[model samples]
Target chain A: MTRSVFFVSDSTAMTSKGLGRSLLSQFNVTLSEHLRPYINTEERVDILLNDIHKTHIEDGDAPIVFASMMDEKLMNKLSQGFAGVIDIFRPFMPTLERLMDKKSSKEVGQAHKVGNQHLYQKRVAAIEYTLATDDGLKTTDYDQADIILLGVSRTGKTPTALYLALNFGLKVANYPFTSEDLPEFTLIKAHLENRHKLVGLIISPERLLSIRRERRALGSYADPKAIAAELAALNSLFARESIPFIDTTTRSVEEIAASIMAISPT
Target chain B: MTRSVFFVSDSTAMTSKGLGRSLLSQFNVTLSEHLRPYINTEERVDILLNDIHKTHIEDGDAPIVFASMMDEKLMNKLSQGFAGVIDIFRPFMPTLERLMDKKSSKEVGQAHKVGNQHLYQKRVAAIEYTLATDDGLKTTDYDQADIILLGVSRTGKTPTALYLALNFGLKVANYPFTSEDLPEFTLIKAHLENRHKLVGLIISPERLLSIRRERRALGSYADPKAIAAELAALNSLFARESIPFIDTTTRSVEEIAASIMAISPT
Candidate 1:
């Protein structure tokens, strides 16, 4: 008899993304999808009760319910019927209550002001850099990239670009460094030439070996010696082309993005 | 004369990009190159003191040192030196201190385990989806994207795509739906027939009028009827192709992304 768990909340809570999915993975139970966004208090309560009734009559397992930012009236009502439910918001209530109590304090107001100001300033700064260009760089377009990433295979480039774009708000463009374009330097054509920065990424031979090995399980591409040769060739080309490259062997995407953001000329 | 404000702290402080930048904008103070990860006590003191000295001696204004998450030892040392500085961490101190005092509580350990399990489950679910794809979907290469974006036109596609990518971790390739792209998309074949999704966002006529007026003060593109017609044509084509589309007139990127993610059939 598998115990079923029901997550009834707004749309954000129901999606297999964000906090809802995170919380659901904890318990060994099935999740009911009856809860959805923009649900009125009455509908939510009905869904909760229905779920409880279904679980009690059919499964005979008292299902656990996790709700986010739920209405107080509805929660109180559900608590009466579903005694097995867990309200996650209860944990954060202390923090929220403390914040509310401190709302009267001058220091709390000042800190909030400072925090809001920081948010605005960052957006403005991001906007300013996003408008620059390369070459004559007269217009705000592709020519203004601080660093353009080009790579082949499973070189973690996109997440790195996004990290640059979101964290630093840098204008980053990436093109695939395919085998046909073996020597990647000369391909830096038109707007990309000498205007924007370029960074090449090289993965370690052994690391590439294992990644490919896991892919096809003992395929020719997974051969360590072949992977090593490919990496060495890529490295040679990078050195010859005078492109600053980093080996993303053991670093998390955050670490790699941070390093790139650090070296990037601001 | 501009007042200099030094924001010194570790990753959490430096990484508070949006919040920090907004605060600095309100003060009319320029942030010096002191922000970095892993700053120690002496470094903090040196930065604060130097900035204070520079503001007093050179700029003839008091320096506002907005420090976040400074070590307690360093905070004490600096507070003694610069009486005028504001310690943002002070607001969070009481709560943090309380938590520290309760470090021995069984509740803390249980809460941590629950949170970790929640995160592990979410990542596991995301990875499960990632592993099933073959077009280098599981791999983190940003360049092989189906659609590359380029537009200064405030087409609002980048933020929209970023919303989809970051939130859903979808391989959403977004090229700016610009005047340039008006010709480009016409020429290139839609590679993502069933494999990927393409979304074109058109802003409302009124919004386009106001946005264009702000930038150029006047333009044919800014004409309400002209803008309306263009959007109508784009909307018609999108509808005809059965391509999913969004009117980013009244929605945040988050909202647009949510809609896209909902319809993405992922």
Candidate 2:
């Protein structure tokens, strides 16, 4: 059976959608998803309520509403009319009030707004640094890097670097170990100079072969034999240098980044 | 007085922290923030509760708790002890039940578990495309891009492009306008070829001047006169070519990206 799910929020609806999707995925059911973002107005909420009621009647079931509305009056109105209204914000406000001994301001759309100029500038700078130092393109600024990620080609280094930069406001630089730099004991000059910031990433040969094949079909880069050899050499190199490495075979970029952060100084 | 706020979650605590920070920022108060992630155990909840009680006695105010726990027993235990417990998830579950006419799975940490392989691969491929075509580096692949952002130096083009790629899985390429390309009304070869995918970004001269000054202390790039001339010329060029442009002076990267998505065909 198909169930309708609506993610409603005063801002982007990203958080609502994320949490809703996660919870819904656990059930053995197909979902028809709808997103209603920037729903800060009473009129907008009314329109959404009408739509929800109509969906409920037409589908012969109540349409589930995942709402992150911060306004108390609007939320109360929604709860009164919709039986399936999931208030994402109100349940937390009373507890916060008792703790701080102050009532919440009940403001909306403040989470994703550019509130702090200093923090915003830092994030922008990190993004710029990530782009500039990507794939070891420019090594002159290695000293400024917060962390450096090294991995073989197509081993999930670039996405990890960008994730670190975006999420944590970190200046992350990533380098790839090409075939020419492999099968030897010595490290590259840049890696040697910035050994302290090095974090290695390695993937299983089977996974690496498939990823490489997607990028360049019918090439030795995707050969299982070559991939196995490279991974073995790289593993030894990481062990020799005492560099921490993670296998990205079954991990997401977030998992890989969190692991790197936990192990690395950055 | 300093108020303490704890963001407790059974998973990454990202949603709890995001919404909590946004709501708390509306009040003019000093807050000591803490995040307690992966609080899935009864033992862990006991420790958190003890910490909250101690903070309350020490500060003479109860500590604010923003929790997204999915476990009913743990949440009940928390509410019984913590006067300031904000239940982030449970309040919405009942409404969801009535709407879907089914009980929730009540699972945790599933929102960002790399569930869909196809979507994950698409996001990775988009990131690669964005890095490859950044700052007009590889115009040969412009035909494959979903969107192209154009602006003068430091008009918030790169961050917007990266945000589009990271958030929406869109292949975004950005180009900066230089003085050499100014004064004449003719479009560049690449712009002429992919005019349909183009989205122009314009910023206020004062803001542009300051941003450029931050990058280069004393150069023509940062000069107010140079910024004014470039912005005027770029505006006329966009008008002449009937290209859509957004003013990035007051908008956040998220706002700018949403506007671009609304207007762009992609």
lDDT of 1 by residue, A1-266 (tens): 25455554433332212233333333323444333333336765776588578877876555555554335666677767776555543443333234223222211112123333344234323433432331223333445566766555556665556545644556665555444444332444533364437677788777666666655666556767656556666677667677777667765444566556545565
Where model 1 places Cα greater than 4 Å from the true spot, the runs are: A1-144, A150-152, A166-169, A173-202, A212-222, A233-247, A250-254, B1-9, B12-15, B19-35, B38-155, B171-202, B209-223, B230-247, B250-266
lDDT of candidate 2 over A166-247, digit per residue (tens)? 7677999998777776565457787789899998898888788888898887766888887877888889899989998887
Model 2, B175-222: lDDT tens digits are: 878866766435678878999999999889888887778888787788
DockQ (C-alpha based) per candidate is: 0.09, 0.38
Report per-prediction Cα RMSD to one decimal: 10.4, 3.9
Could you say which candidate leads in DockQ?
A: 2
Best by TM-score: 2
Which pairs of residues have clashing backbones in candidate 2? none
Fraction of the real A/B interface contacts present in each candidate?
0.01, 0.31
Candidate 1, B17-132: lDDT as tens digits: 32333334333334443444334557646765765776667755555555543356776777677754455434433432342232222110121132342333333233233222
